[model samples]
Target chain A: MPRYGIPEYRLPYEMLDRDIDVITSLGVKIETNTRVGSDISMDQLHTDYDAVVLAIGLHLGRSTRIPGAEHKQVCKAVDLLRNITDGDKFKLPKQAVVIGGGNVAMDIARSLARLQKQKFGGVKVTVTALEDRAHFLADPVEIKECSEEGIEIFDARGPQECIIEKGKLKGLRTWKVRSIFDEQGRFAPAYDESDELIHEGDMIIEAIGQMSDVSILGEQLTEDLEWNRGRIQVDDNGHTSVEWFWAAGDCVKGPDVVHAVADGHRVAGSIERWLVGRQK
Target chain B: MTEGHSSDYERLQSKKSLAEILEVAVEFERTARDFYTNLIPKVSKQIRYLVEELAEEEQHHFDLFSKLKSRPDIEQLIQAMVDTPASDQRFSDAIHLPDLGEKPDDQAVLQFALGREHAAMEQYRSLAESTEEGPIKELFLFLANEETLHKNQLEKLYYETIHSGGV
Candidate 1:
């Protein structure tokens, strides 16, 4: 639990697994490969355990619905990072461009830099974001590493279209971002026409954000549960409206590993306390 | 807000004069080095090592600036801290002293690290703006880039500390 000065952000999947093993060894039971809503039914879980805490994370990547976004070379930033961390190898293009300015975008950019160095002997990566450099949501350190690794950063550029020629990705065409959010704080981007740039790249990765997949909750349970925006609603203790069920992690709070751990602790304590109250 | 002094400093293009810039850089590096050195004794051995490493890096910057200052084309100017008078004597009187026994909390340490990185970034930005020479501009830009990287590293540490619910 003491992660002081530990490089947990860029840790490999196997290292995370090992860390989980260490936690499990400390008398906390951990189940693996058990897919909820598939491996077991909700009714069955309700009958077996007093409370079911859903700690499933946000895995679905937000996509840019620009023209030619369906091109094969265009991939989600999250997928690219996950694949690279899984030790998978592929022949990347001589030049690559990542779109977005979040932490995940930086992670992919840095990961690609490492790959580029190992294979090509130099860095040829570019990151384009809608926000100005100062307003970028990504931790400043990520931006710094991307620059240090020789990646060019083009700020205040919003993707207008993904250029494709003869079934091959040629580059991306973007307009100057006038503003990212609307007056109402919604995600409506205003672009400037006079300022436009075409960034040449064989591959483009989108890292805007991610969303939860609660479809497995089924229509009945989903309708019965309280809602907040598109996420399932839960109390402070990770309790759902239904007494037998709970939800936590990225599915409830979005993507963050430490948050998931905290959510797990809260739900576990709540379940234990509820069970004890029932016994009394 | 001495308008005449501000105008004079602005016109001098202190940024273009490697010697003048180096003087300010040396002073900044010395102050940061002193801060870290003094901070080391107040913390645990692990944190002390980190602060010492930072102090050494600051010393390296001081040495680099000193070498730059010795260049023939360089001209000496009063350091920024000396030129701009502030109520807080800590800014003016701070020395490159060794660490005392006051260990800062994790947040405080992170704040210090952030301030250091911000100063380095600002210094490089000023250097970039003042210098017209190509090589000197490039050098300043490169240093700025490096400072940004350091800033990021510190920020990651800060956020991770917060994520861990802080000790």
Candidate 2:
């Protein structure tokens, strides 16, 4: 059978780099190390360039609403992966509990397992998720690898709180999940409180989801921009409510390489037509 | 000396089922992804393009293996395969990737890509040979061919970068 899902899947980092090379070769100018509304200023870029496409992706990994969620010991899965990718030799935790069931959670769990195996000569990582094994969002192969690598996974557990004692993260407390979705298929988790369990660990990682860093929009622009259900409103062609500015990528939609790619093409096409209209 | 981590990693590397083979394939792609993406920001502008493209190719391979990983037989096959002994590859520190902040230019990136593609191609080739004519065999051959295509692309790109006065 043919491999890959809709619109074909390609790695993001690689695709961006190679495409940048191709585009640069075609005489397009690109700049890096310039953060929007910070280093270079988003308003400046908007005014300087004829058309601006905000393709910033959702980089901040989501954290659960629980006490001690803001504790230093609690790490975002994206941050952990970013630090690892950005070459940080972080002090490896002896025991870690990753709270999520998605692929990112599996990845962090395995990554921690590798670190723990190196540090203490064994894996002491646990992954807890609200969804049962049958409903886990991570690929089965990833789950299998997690078992092979000695990382434990517990399903049907809803994270109720991050257990912190004396301002130190001690563990993650969770109740048994009865149902993850309601009859309407919405995320309305029902937990069995009597079956509460406190999983002991030195470190806690959150990998539920990710969101965009739109702080760079500044207070005024953020207020001016129209939002759809908390996301920057954009049309099917990625055109925003305001002309001369467009939004796409994870910032507009959610995470997925395919969707981001489609957004890229759409934005490019829209920009082309826009510039053409301006010229005429 | 803590050879345990490396050894355990090698154990994970050992293929037991078609699923394990595909999983191993995904892991290698991840390693390649890490290696190349890390190299991109650190390298000079002249060579960043090459490293980025190489990284992209690794991610592409990762995606393919990921698709292969979702086959119907894997869930059951892995349970039984876990009991088998680990492979005895001498170099066990494969998981300890080089510090990406340094240690690679254009040529090095290409060479790394070449190494990864070669190893994966060989694994897939052997797999294809061992299996009887079926969907499984075809998958292995396809993966192997994918690697071959990458190998060729890297080789040509390597030549271009080298002879073009800047890599």
Candidate 3:
């Protein structure tokens, strides 16, 4: 996440290097460019190590699963963020319609704005979200900067379809959101279908949420592991159902770097206690 | 003992040309790859996985060196040199799996791996310092970074596996 998730403008590579240097300075050895599942199996980790901690953060971007969401012009904000970070070349859009009201949505929108400003000499990005401006999931600073970059914000809109014309993306059709949650506080959005509008754009980006890639845990291990909702279940100290196995970070908690770091500390303490007991 | 090693390094450094140095590097990578590949089956599944990765990296290094050798401006690339101590195969040669006996424990294997990675890091750093700003210099610097990461991983594994109390 540090390398490929965050933009260089936000968190420079040198800053990351310094942070890593701090750990290496403490005589902590780290391996890079190694995939845990493919490079080393869970079974092997269980056999060899005293304890194994999974800090696999949320990587895959969640889809809105709305109609025409599978259009070629439709993309995920997380994937675009990663692509931008990696300096991967893609056709910069003249007009972009973002489908969410979160930091990730802002990140992609701002990034696209920057690219558009660079390539097309202007910013033409529209952010459409179900939440009202008062209840935006994104940070206020991000929302402010998103406008400062000349991107339009269309709050209180529920995405209905990716408006396509001649097999090409024309814009995003959205309905005016009446209420986002049900009476019981469930995530059932009530939209005023009568109130609809189409925000013209060449691209649509969905940044609603993120989920961890648990396929790395392997089939048997995944089935064996306990889960709370979609997240891996863990004790207060980060210990899992299996005694030697532990989970922390965005995979268990949520998508915040501070929380992940705190989780790391918690897991370390838990593992230390478990190991001491084992030695006894 | 240190003076003797320093003099030996000087002698080797002075006697070798760019092509000859690259040839030695190629040989080093090949040996390291073969060493890791052969050792994989003898170790535990987890260690074997690590060794397998190390072997793959060594092979990559070998390809990089080979490509560097075939570069048209290879001979003229070394415009400057730093007076850093260049590492040879002396450190790696001093250790062997056979010396640890058959069925060496995980700790012993990890320690051995750590030592080799340290040697590789130094060797690449030495190579990096010997060249001016160009692909050769960049390649060695990249290699040095990779080796440092490899050393770190081995050390981390060692601490976690052998000294679980502290980790």
Candidate 4:
């Protein structure tokens, strides 16, 4: 089994590991460290197998697009998580600011809290988001745990700019978010200018969203394949317009581990059926 | 309730033995007891206490069945137990003892117990329907009624939590 993306949630990791072990025990040769659309060449894949499955997950982090977002200290949430999980040592600042309200934001905030606890004898990770506490996207259990761990959370804040002083990190300026989405279901945050706060932080982590990088498909193949709102268009069985290529996982259905697993199963079944039919 | 004559009592009793019904009753009690025990740790302190009481009620059911099992003529009970449907097999299998090490929070536990009570009430109702005549049928009906009572109590607790934000 191919393990892509960060592994923090234990359920999918445990389930996938168990399944891979079981499948391997049954005499299936499962290759390891082969990242489709990246590490392994598509040419080699086409030459070796009749069909190629693209399960390359969405790892591209979304940007906040606020002023001073390009600062050296402002890092993507995924990168930070990957670095932490890989046991890489970094000098985390005394105060850190996390931007977003999703589960990913919660995970990074909690992880940073633990790290700060270990380093500074206390946690000083602050999470700010457009959504209120009740409307937060993080699971209630996660929110409760974060509160229990003493991580500071500020809700309904729309980031305006990262404050800098003499080319040094100072803090972040945010206006109170009156509302996040517009009437037409678009991202148009309305902010209350009167209600403004300057949150002091040495580092800022963006955990807004993620997308797939399809640039590796090359300009020629990109035009040849069907596209649906920037995502690769696939049939019900995960079959792409190109018969030889099948795509699944986060590349096709966004970043959900269970959805990826379900997509894999569907695409595998479809491939098996197609191959069997061709033999007949 | 009208007391029947000896001949009427014999006629009703002889239709199916008491031994069979007692067997099924024992199984149902075991399942209910296991479900309650499993649910205790998942609920709040008050809910846990309530579930413990439910488990005790299941023990009472077991004792009732045991008494019926010791009767001289239990042929009706035996027949009733034998004819019990396989639908309840799921209940028997799924009724796990509580895992004390990793207790779920209060809301989860209460919801679980509430669900189990609803399922048990349905199962007992079906069991009651499968029996015919005399004390065997009466016993099944009595157990079913008790399950309904437990279900009502659990429902009340569930609603109370929902409205009061206790869970």
Q: Which candidate has the highest TM-score of all? A: 3
TM-score to native of every candidate shown:
0.58, 0.57, 0.60, 0.58
The best candidate by lDDT is 3
Question: Interface RMSD in Å per candidate, to 1 decimal?
Answer: 17.7, 21.3, 18.8, 21.4
What is the alpha-carbon lDDT for the whole of candidate 3? 0.75
Error of 3 at A128 (Å): 0.4
Q: Give the TM-score of candidate 1.
A: 0.58
lDDT of each: 0.68, 0.71, 0.75, 0.69
Residues A44-148 of candidate 4 have per-residue lDDT tens digits of 777899998887676666666578988888887777877776678777878989888777788878888888988899989888887778667777887888889
lDDT of 2 at B83: 21
After superposition, which runs of candidate 3 have C-alpha atoms over 4 Å from their true positions?
Answer: A182-186, B1-167
- Which ten contiguous residues of candidate 2 chain A have the minimum total lDDT? A1-10
- The candidate 4 chain A region of ten consecutive residues with least summed lDDT is A1-10
lDDT of 4: 0.69
Cα lDDT, model 4, residue A232 = 78
Evaluated at residue B162, the lDDT of candidate 3 is 34
Chain B vs. true chain B: TM-score for each candidate?
0.64, 0.74, 0.68, 0.61
Off by over 4 Å in 2: A1-19, B1-167
Candidate 4: TM-score of chain A is 0.89
lDDT of 1 at B82: 19
Candidates 1 onward: DockQ, in order: 0.01, 0.01, 0.01, 0.01
Tell me the lDDT of candidate 1.
0.68
Write the residue-wise lDDT of candidate 4 on B37-85 in tens digits.
7766554342345667768877886787677677666543454433444
